[model samples]
Target chain A: MKNQTVLFRSPVPVAETATIAGPKEKEGPLHAYFHYTLEDDLLKQDSHEHAEIRLHVGVLKQLLNRAKLSPQEIDCAFAGDLLDEIIGSNFAMRELDIPFFGIYNACATFGESLILGSCMIEGGFAERVTCSVTSHFATAERQYRYPLELGCQRTPLSQWTVTGAGATLLDKNATSKIKITSGTIGKVVDYGIKDANDMGCVMAPAALSTLRTHLQDTGRTVDYYDKIFTGDLGYSGSLLLQKKASETGIILHNHEDCGNLIYNRIAQNVESGGSGACCCGLVFNGYIYDQLQKGRLKKVLLMPTGALLSKTSSLQGESIPAICHAVSVEVIE
Target chain B: MILNKEEQKVYKKEIKDVAPKTKHISTLLRAFFTGGTICCIGQGVNQVLGILLPSLTEEDRGGYTTLLMIFFTGILTAFGVYDHIGNFGGAGSIIPITGFANSIVSQAMEHKREGIIFGICSNMFAIAGPVIVMGITASVVVGIVYLFL
Candidate 1:
């Protein structure tokens, strides 16, 4: 379909959600928000790959438990991770035993999963579905950049990859107040930014494109939502978005970036704040979800952005193409 | 709505202003002092070796000094001490031979769980492999020059 907008006829309720993070992430500003925090990044697993899988399994189990449901009760599972071949999600699905749909949009996997999960329910394909995404700093570092032991100095433009996993269960008939109302699938937008270290520069334009498109298609303005959240744009990209939005007359008065909100930039040495799929996953599933439950947030526009560049492509001097998926969540009193 | 060429340039400038600036002064100062201290220590060790091994030739003494530094660094890395020093010293600890030793030993320790042959032995020099390769290549070039001379 040429149309990117998918306004749902039936509102999908997020019945339950859970988030798990490493010690560093738990020590961040949103420490009190997460459901579980690991003492170490590895979760006592031998390899980071295994630890990532464990994290995914942990969150899924917690979400299922909290919803008072089992894996067998889930009609489908939409999950992914920032791993080559999506092995982390694949490994986790082996234990999940649910019909799995693996997705990969780099750091935007969480939003992609949410959009698809909402589609499946709205289309009456499934009554209950679980949407999840995982990212571990160790795994992503070794895969994309360097080994932890290398002690390579990070560029100021770079962001710390988040070590966390977040999962949410959506039910068609659930009595939950928070509901997914609409979604806008993002197109691949490239600004020809080649520096992999400055991913925020590569992704900000994509976030802007998606946000603008979503607002235009819905015939709504920024004030239509209580707050607008962009996933993993960090400090620089978030500021750039605000600048561009103001220039285009789309003043985002209550805008927050998951990347900037995930960590205390001054206290933690997170140069440009946090990145990776878990940035939005943890922030949305933990903090934003809590706000919805408390009736504090009536509606929110979540635009999780992703820089779609493989290590091979970046190494070969290719510019990063970015994507963002926006989902409108409204609390149904 | 991808930005055009001129718009990209304008946006890039804005991004540069908004981006976090690298802390060069503190990092440079830390690297300078740390690197200087390690070099000073090397000189001290060289002097001590000269007195201890008076019978040995100057080149042999130099070799012994290098070995001692590497041994010291290996021990520090094994005891999880070099990591702290490296964190604090930044480029200083890395510019010395001790830094080279720390890299290999730490990588070996990290992969020790994968077993001996593949994990420890094979992957020990994964990070330092480039340095070793370049060192050998450079030495071969010097050897060729020496032959011509």
Candidate 2:
């Protein structure tokens, strides 16, 4: 099947979850939901790079502890980060003795990792799989945009990079009721957007395309999912998606973006809202997961979007290309 | 999922309305006055240097004033105060020699952990590189034209 949606006959259950965030994120609206929060972005580490590694390790370790399983007991670990070469996930996974699949899909990495992890379990390749992603504001800023010392003023359209990490443990034996039903892998779509500062605008089209495709592939309507969430489209992207989706006659009534959900839009100075790979990771694992566990929410269609632009491409006057992957999770009581 | 040419045209137009728009007139006024104030301060520094170094030539005094501005900007950048000026002043903080110093020193500080040679020295010219390249090129062109004339 070429770019077909995967439907699991035997649903894989979400066994455990953990999220670790920085001080800035802890100050946001979802602060109470995080499993752990750091006092500083650096986490007392010697450098921002080291701090990013600590974020990944912290979430993975916390999830292991919560699940009461050792790292050696896990069948596989799928992880990623928004750094050059995904150094945060790579370096952190070195501490775990389990088989590691280092993945990268920019901000959409969590959705990518989740789909793959579910496939591994459903295919009988692994019994227990851990999926995780990490992103640090300081580290990401230095790599993608500019150096911290320059203190360049961020444009109003710019989305703040989320400083956090999120991990979830999935088991094939139906240990927990929260199960992944289906997923749709996105294709890279470019709409000729050149501005690097307005990432939300660049990514919205991809999000819309994936949303429409996911619904079509699964033979589901907008009402099928209780909540539809996009990764880090922020305020502008979410609005743009709503506008575009309506034009195609598919209205998303219960739609929200992790970028918009992570912070208080009116109170916080997060211009367009939170972004980065960890934006969705933190919100879904922290806020959305809590809502589901409490039986307040049931079916969720989580689509994490990513703009695939490197520093080199953006510098060379290239338009931004984006992708979004959709995964449906339901609490089957 | 790539868009066709027709689809792209529609997206480009739609996105223009979707993206945030900044007011140009206000920003321009702020930049102009801020930049003017910085030049005025440089002139003031030049006058003070002339009084302190009475025997120095006019050319030497001008050179010293530039050095002083660069030094002041570097210190300001280190203290993280220059960023506020840059934010409010726009081009005002960036058009002067101080802005040039800010760029180099700030970049060096940012990459300092990578080591002196690979980190600091290598990144020292990142923001200033294009400016240096164009400046030298323009000078060479003007020099040749003058010679021919």
Candidate 3:
């Protein structure tokens, strides 16, 4: 391992991916790429939490079906969500027979799971692994901010929590050209931002920190990858990251944020952009994965950024600490 | 990663510079109109009550108007309309008695799945709790001052 980065000798192939987007996300530009789109976000469940769990289960099942593998064939699964204690992933795992590892790093959970799953495959610990994440707008709203029906106005900086789940299946034996090449673990970076609504500003520094570390460790320039995709740094946040990166002499010419790409901000009424754990999950598994498969994008760096702030911490006036994990995916001949 | 005070200050300033500024003038205008319309509706309700019951005291009409506003807000909240009003009106919709009803009603609806005691009842005041506390505290202080006077 070179500092925080791991270069896999035998790159694990991404065999299959499945995504289930919500009603609102279904209307987005990349709607056609998703494997399934929910007719109703509630899915007839009594609560949004249960609906999120169901979405998680649906995506996992879809991945298995696409890969033609049973739950028994999968050695282990890594998953997480934005919910307290990660109940979305936990309850979903209960319905599946695969061994599970429940993890959390806020919205960057998908990246953490990908890195860990790839490590398991590269280390000879597991032959086949599944990494998944989920998030629901209503559930996240009730937990992190105001109730769904509350007549409180959203701040201009506030992001809409994405309602969806995505899962990726990695196999050592799969002949897929798309493979996990390397990964860089992020350090928790806090620049003393207190406003939870301005998450893009909060998480942008962490994304920049991880991106810098990844470049330093790999000895690669910013142009090494076709694009560097950050998780949920809505519009303003991505601009902040770009400005800050350029200030440090690292120009982010090919940087795009999943939050920004997932929704039409003005038309969708998502003030900033789409956020939550599934923000990157859906975009990566659906849109980015499709691009890679079609050879439109050969090399890509996926850096999922997370803001580690709880309701109690924000209420207590503690600053938000953020983390970002970068996994380089490439198409190998 | 750690940054010194100076670096933190610089970064904070950069964040502020990058963030999109809120449209203050437009927001103020919207708030003014929305709040004024709501107050007008309250007055209209009071007048209707007065005409309906000629013998009722002024205090009774005032109390009933408040009740009517809360009831209307509760219905709008249940039907999921007030949140959109809030989205457009911003502070206009949020500074009225309707907003208070919305705070309590929304919480109750959100926590209904957790069961009555621990869910709806406990969380009902999640947002309104602070407002109620501050109101009572200020009122008590004023009452004591009046007693001395």
Most accurate candidate by lDDT: 3
Across A56-114, the per-residue lDDT of candidate 3 in tens digits comes to 99999999999999999999999999899999999999999999999999999999999
Q: Place model 1 in a CAPRI quality band.
A: acceptable
Error of 3 at A232 (Å): 0.9
Q: DockQ for each of the predicted structures, in order?
A: 0.44, 0.56, 0.84
- In candidate 3, how many Å is residue A126 off? 0.6
Candidate 1: pairs in clash: none
Which stretches in model 3 have alpha-carbon errors above 4 Å? none
- The digit string of per-residue lDDT tens for model 1 on A295-327 reads 898999999999999999998987789999999
Overall lDDT per candidate, in order of appearance: 0.89, 0.89, 0.94
Q: Against the true chain A, what TM-score does chain A of candidate 3 give?
A: 0.99
lDDT of 2 by residue, A1-333 (tens): 225689899888998899998888898989999999999888888889999998898899999999999989899999999889999989998887889999999999999999999999999999999999999998988898876766355677899999999999998874688999988999899998888988898899888888888888888999998999999998888889999999999888999999998988658777889999999999999999998899888999999999999999998998899999999999998
Ranking by DockQ: 3, 2, 1
The 10-residue segment of model 1 chain B with minimum total lDDT is B79-88
- lDDT (C-alpha) at residue A104 in model 2: 96
The digit string of per-residue lDDT tens for model 3 on B1-149 reads 66777988888899888788899999999999998899999999999999999888999999999999999999999999999898788789989999999999999999999999999999999899999999999999999999999
- Over the full model, what C-alpha lDDT does candidate 3 score relative to the true structure? 0.94
